[model samples]
Target chain A: MASPARGNHVWVGSETGILKGINLQKKQATNYKFGDAVLSRHEAVTTMCWGDPYESEIYVGCLDGSVKLFSTEKGKFTESRDCREGEGPFCGLAVLDGSLITCVQSGLLKVWRDTSSENVEIQVGPGVCRMCQNPEQLHRVATGGKENCLKVWDLHQPQEPIFRAKNVRNDWLDLRVPIWDRDMQFLPGSEKIVTCTGYHQVRLYDPSSPQRRPVLEATFGEYPLTALSLTPDANAVVVGSSRGDVAVIDLRQGRLVKCLKGFAGSVRAIQCHPALPLVASCGLDRFLRVHNLHQKRLEHKVYLKSRLNCLLLTSREKWENEDSPAELQSDVKEEEDDEIWNSMEVVATKRKAETQPCCESGNKEPRKDKPSRKKKIRKAES
Target chain B: MAEKLGKGRTSQKAQHNAEKAEAVASPGEGQGAPVQPDQVLFPPSFSVSEIKNKQRRHFMFLRWKQQQRKEKLAIKKKRKKEREALGDKAPPKPVPKTIENQRVYDETTVDPNDEEVALDEATDEFAPYFNRQTVPKILITTSDRPRGKTVRFCEQLSKCIPNSHVYYRRGLALKRIIPQCMSRDFTDLIVINEDRKIPNGLVLSHLPDGPTAHFRMSSVRLRKEIKRKGKAPTEHQPEVILNNFTTRLGHSIGRMFASLFPHDPQFVGRQVATFHNQRDYIFFRFHRYIFKNEKKVAIQELGPRFTLKLRSLQKGTFDSKFGEYEWIHKRHEMDTSRRKFHL
Candidate 1:
């Protein structure tokens, strides 16, 4: 079970309180539950995140206000903890230096430490739709929701937000535009955060910039956008609407890049591979679909049999490898060897033209020329 | 008796084949291949259409049609005679091919013994109805200012559904109406939307919480429009029949339709309402049956029949803009293969 769990490329959290591990190569899905307890909607998984950089430990937050720790190494739930401070389902979950950080829909964000007395808490705001931690800066996290604008907080000081975003200007009718950031992601290599709104708009917020309002904003379909994931390059963002419309929108010009097809329902969660041009999305349709971002082709689709809310994708380059870095190094060695062979061919051509022709003309005789000459060179090299 | 049945079947098959051939011949003629049929019938590719005189051409075409029919009848007669002579040793009749039989294999077809799917269905929104914890109280209405057949259709629909009430829309939004209906102890809401006085859309929202389903309604035949429909239905509850709901999506739709009616049907009413699914289109029929002796049963069609093709299934009640959809039909992407069906 542990070995097969390690082979899984995607881990999906479903509404039926089942954790599904899908191995794309084998086209198999394995369901993992916590205990002998019957599956219930109260324990429905709402958010999931890696507990460490190694991606071996997963922290799954449930609607019932408890967080379960799943170890991919053992392919089982190793520990279950209660973080019932929040009023609603968890909006986001992250781990920082062994400490678990959880934010709920009712805006209760807490940091769970080894000791109960040491845990820190912060009130982000009411109706927190989503909270996401910055991958580069583990201490930084952002929160946003309905009628609540974007706010970035530093975990070091939970007193107040470091950067608070202001809502966009009113519309042409001089009416206030509603603010609802359904899902958000932090752009790697930068402080810019991209968010998809319930108003069907995708807004990019740059905390480094002076303007608190969105640096750029773009709208896609007519329905509310539920989920968004940044592409590996981070030049464009993929957003899925409540009506199951998934599209990639360019950040630079805010232009629509392309649309992914074959989605039957509203997409709840979307995750793009950290390095590969592949994005996996799952939703109310109960199907986990992985699409090629470059070609916009649906590559793999697995029927999970329950509504999916969140998903975590393995970041390893080679899925079949137990230790991917070692295999990657071996791959690099093959490329280096090919380079050396190419350079040797160039040297052989230069030597043949510069020396072989001159020697043949001077002798005016071909006495075992090709074989003896190549053998002599080989002998000299050895 | 067997020989007569065999003869009738053969005649039907021959007539069907002739009709198909005629259809093919008409298309060939439209493409300027007037001699196509003549080429098949004779070695010399001479067509009656090539005749200079219009009267002669018409006369020759009539003669050709008669000849084709006579040849078809003779062939059918020969096959029938051969089958009759064989008697009990006759070959089994060939089964006809249809898109339903040739459907693409659906991976989500629910197996009865599948524990996960059984648990899922047991905990779904309609679980209360299946568990008999809540009684079905349906509220049927129409789009604001419904006219003509749309209004009458809702009235007839309400008659078959026990504890159902038909009301006017009054132009109120569905989002606002849902809360009031919940407070009023209504378990389900049915909204019939019409375009140009013709019912074209049906929205069924399981109340309080949902899994609202939207369907494209077509081919409406009200009592007045029907040729030989039965009288007005009685107040007694009708038995509900759901057919061909095999896939997971289809199962959910079937369960939704089932929850709209009462659990224990009044058998004394002798009326049955059926939602038969064929190639993804759901055909609704309400009928009254009479048990003719112990061996035979005859059914008479009650009024108001229509067809429904699923458009979308939303998660929560009537919030089309914000509610998450469970399944939505994408015409271009999903309809690529005629054999592929969602429900």
Candidate 2:
């Protein structure tokens, strides 16, 4: 179990309470069941997150209000604790500096520390759908749900929200627009928060701005969007809808970029690689699919034999191919050379002479030579 | 072909020489060509429809069909004789290709001995029904203002399953009806939707908790429409036969159909309910059987048969707007291959 779990690229939580580890390089899947009891939906994993930056440990939150800690090194569950503060299944799970943060559907958010007396419990609001931590600022976490607007709380303060999003204006009919933020992510380099709502809208909120409402809003397909993840470049987001439509939406232009196909059910979770152009998604279709973001092509599809609830993609680089690191190093060296060339100045006449044909011939030479060269080669062969 | 068209639109004398010249030169031109050797044996292009005289064309077509049949029979006879002569040394016969036999490989096909699938089935929504913990009490309703044919179809379906009740929809929302059904101890809710006086959709939702299945219902035949159907079904429980439900999704669907009936079947009634799935279409049939002799059995079809194609399977009860779908039939994406089947 330790050997198989070591190189796994993705970890998917299924509705059957089985934690599946998939090694994309080997095309092998290993299932880790916690106990000897009968497999039941009561213990189905509702949410999962890495316990630390190294991703060696996993925190699995189940529907039965138990949070089990799994160590990838040992390939076994190390600890299990009942987070019984909430009334419903866990909506989200996160780890901040070795402490565990869990939020349930009943709006109970609890922070568990090494000492029981230091535990902090906060009620964000009722009907909370998701609670996610800001990666850049470890202490900041956001919570939103049905009828619950986006609220970013500073865990250090715990008294008031640092940033609270106001609801968008009413529709043309003068009725209040609904609020159902199914999933959200914090942009890496900025204070902007991107969220996908159950009403099929993708909204970007800038906490640093004076306005409390979302600055940019874009709607995708008709069905409610269930999950979303930002691309590695952080310029676009991949959103999945309840009707199995997954598309990349450009955050800057608020435009649809490209749609990834071959999904047959509602997408429950999507996690994009932090560096690679790949996105892994799993849903009720019972298949985990990895799509290449650049090519927009499905790369791998594995049938895990149960409805999937959540997904976690490894942030490790060079997992797809071992030889990629050498190529990436050469690319970095070439970029450095290009920077040196750009820094040097040249005489005005020589620069004009060097740049004119380079620009004109670069575009014209290929068109003029390609067909004629092919014809000459054909004639010589004949 | 050109001559035949010209012969209809204008006088026969007009373009008669050109038509004759072309038709006479066409076959000669084919024979003269070096690229097409088969053109010598057959004309370049000729169809019976191009023949001007309808009577003569019909006669020629019939004779051609008969000749083809004769050739096929001759090949069969020759093969059989060769096989008989070399009975001990004949090679194995080649299997014919069929859509089912050449079906695309489905990774989700359940292996009976697989422990995970068995465990999954054991704890699914149908576990109580399969474990005999909950008695099967079905409430069959129709879309509001159901027509006579759909109405009669539901009535006939109720007769086939024991402990099933047919209820009028009475213009109530299914969401509202679900809570009322749960309080009354209903184990299943089946709603038949009709369009243009014909039943076109069927929604089967498991009660209390659900994995609701929506199916496109077609080719519905009532009792009076069936030719030589048996009498109205008896009240005793009938044995259920589910065929070709091989995949994981198919297993769930098969279990849903199986749970609609009681646990113990009454053999004395000799009644059977079969849900036969082929190429993703489920055919429902009720029959009564009797063994006449050791090797011979007679079966009579009961009333009301229909075909169902699964449209979607939702995780919860009757919330299309917000409910998550387990599997959905996307015609453009999923139906790209003819030999591919979901159930």
Candidate 3:
């Protein structure tokens, strides 16, 4: 019987428009290139979403407004489609109920179907920085940005936002507060939405509440917060700033739990493992680092040599029973061959030295050398 | 007896051979000059003044004197070159004057016998207006002509001010923009006018009041100068320095200016912005940081430093004529006059 693949693989999107799959167990990375010259050099992979719950197909959004679907099994791009003209360089992508949903920076959210020419389009707002889908309620998505505060939209309704964030009242100085939400995520099992802003603020908005403003507001470093991810337990969120500072903020207390160091560039994407207490992050620094949440130690680090924009972690259960027995057997045979070859080199050198001086007495020397060659014969047999 | 004699002869011969080998191996050691008894012995103590006199006449002292003379000659040559460059127009000497002895005319220090005082008295009849608030609430806006660069410039300026906001003109008339500003309660308004896709004019107006200043901005460039040499490291954080600000008020003003530009995104690990003020002109220097380590920071100029100058100042609200440009003429006129102004 074959042993299962021991660890999960991380999929990353690079700035050169390449999709990379890194196997943590083998420390091997495989680059999947698009066929037919589809992706240009300047077309960076901006956003990515899995097509199905099984994650067999991945939808990758590019900077040139093209969305390519890649097959995880075949390790190649299966199809490509262009969004409406002047619509993309998508900020977010999601596959819900077999339909493709793409949100552009200009706040055009479009839902496309495979067989129909008709598409549902909604204008969220201009300067939309991020659009995130609620994992619990797949039909609901949130969008926010510069002038466009936070708004949760329902695909079923498609007309207006379900929850629109009202701008906070005038500050203590009676000045209107500016709104700039850079990234947001939905808290699991709740109607609350957590958003990080360019103003260096992390705010949590509960739509179920009567109030329209954020219920909890916390400030981080002076720089803008670029990306954030909820922990598996949903009690805390890991926020990364443009200054490369990453910290876990407690949701209940609105206090910082701990800061994870070692980032030198703006962190682009961060995600925590669903099954294990591990958080994997990638950024402009071109490194994918997996950190243990409990131990606070880096578990694995791989340099992809390209600025990474997005990453997805494969399900850990699928890792089990994934490695084939035939490959493992071949690997063992190759190691044995290497060992035999190394020993053969030493035996050949010894034989040459003995044969050079005994050329005249070669026949007698061969009979005498037979006794001294026992070790070489035994090594070859093994 | 004969056996013992033979062994003794052989040992003596071996010793002589060893001695001969040592002599041949190190001839310089054997031929070294003999040391004098006085040289090996410590010298008698001398007085400190006597030692100093002897040292002053030594070759080391002469070498020091020569180096000093060379430096003095170089300094003299540089001064002579500067003087030659200046020609006949040397900087005027500063005249020392005491506050009590200084004569005042039209609330300005002037010579008692000056003939221009009568003419200046007519200008001093108007009272000065002051906006007392220290912290500024600014609204940054671009001209009706909207371009990508202008919008980006407006966005950068908005980020520089903590309480400021960016609003694109989007072909909206000033009549419509004013009401929106009033509703939003913006204390000040800044409009950047672009000509041929280049920012050439800036209009600063106090909201709900008059007196707008127009400035001419020249030499606008974006990230055109920043060049990425190698792979940007993971830990690079851009450093921001606002230089040449003096007191606490100046520090606050410097901070307000620094807040106009967005936090360095640090995409290439070396983006830096330096705002340096000399006299009334502010020079903006944007560059890429080159750091070998924490202690070594190298600045590679990314683009040409931009210089801003005040072109014109209107007395009252942007287009309306009401107050005189006394604030521009004398910055401390309001503080000294103790007059109240309505906004």
Candidate 2's displacement at residue A156, Å, is 0.9
Kindly report which residue stretches of model 1 are placed more than 4 angstroms away from their true locations once superposed: A320-382, B1-45, B81-91
Segments in model 2 whose C-alpha atoms lie over 4 Å from true places: A35-37, A320-382, B1-50
For all candidates in order, the CA lDDT equals 0.87, 0.87, 0.67
Instruction: List TM-score (chain A only) for every prediction.
Output: 0.84, 0.83, 0.82
Which residue pairs show collisions in model 1? none
Write model 1 residue lDDT over B1-343, tens digit each, in one string: 9796676555444444544554322212322333333233322234456677999877767765775687678779988999999999999987898898889999999999998889889998999899999999999998899997888899888887889999889999988889999999999999999999999999999977898999999999888888778888998889999999999999999999999999888899999999999999999999999999999999999868999999999998998778899999999989999899887
Per-residue CA lDDT of model 2 for B167-205, tens digit only, reads 999999999999999999999999999999999999999
Model 3 agreement with the true structure over B1-343: per-residue lDDT tens digits:
9686565445334433433554322111212433232443222232123335575536444553454466468668867787788988966645887432252222122333543222222222111112222334578888886687777777655543445788767887765676677677665678888888878777767556534556667766554433543232233333567765542223323444543333444556556667775543457765566678989987666433455555434434554221223122223322243231100
In angstroms, how far off is A351's CA in candidate 1? Answer: 36
Q: State the local distance difference test value for candidate 1.
A: 0.87
Candidate fnat values, all: 0.89, 0.72, 0.00
| Chain A TM-score, prediction 2 | 0.83
Q: Rank the candidates by DockQ, best first.
A: 1, 2, 3
